[model samples]
Target: MAWLWLVLGGLFEVGFTTCLRNVDGFRHVGWTLGFLASVSLSMLLLEVAARSIPMGTAYAVWTGIGALGTVLTGIWLYGEPATPVRLLLVVGAVACIAGLKLTAGS
Candidate 1:
């Protein structure tokens, strides 16, 4: 359950970041509200998960998921660079995230 919360938190992390792109420095009211809501939910979920999961592990997994999702979202939605090297690095991050999960012993 904690793991699920962590994953959900990570997804919200990605949501907040994606929302930030449309916030226009907080000038865009709707996007700004979305960003605030997402970030708040993300942090709340993280805190809940951390109560059971090791803080370091939880944080790493959460950030990894966010980063992985954000990178993919950027490439798909914003047309960001998806060069071979960039993708390779992303894969490496995925590997590290998997490694952390495997070793966490949760």
Candidate 2:
């Protein structure tokens, strides 16, 4: 279930990133706490997953998931530019992540 933990960790990565937006430079107390908690949980889960998954593969996947999710959320919720090039690049990142997973032989 290391893969599962990795996925969950990735999700928490997204959570912490999203929560960071609300931190208002750490002026917002509640959002700051949420961000801290999410970061802790995400890192904890990553550490657990790394015991079974190769460090490189797991780290790439985790960051890839977080980047992909955060970009999508920014486009959808924050009106960030959803340029065609940006979308294609994100998809390409997913493809690379998938390739990494498939080749990992885990």
Tens digit of per-residue lDDT, candidate 1, span 11-101: 9999999999999989999999999999999999999999988999999999999999999999999999999999999999999989988
> Over 4 Å off in model 1, which ranges?
none
lDDT of 2 by residue, 45-84 (tens): 9999999989999999999999999999999999999999
Give me the candidate number with maximum TM-score.
Answer: 1
Q: Cα deviation of 80 in candidate 1 (Å)?
A: 0.2
Indicate which candidate wins on lDDT: 1
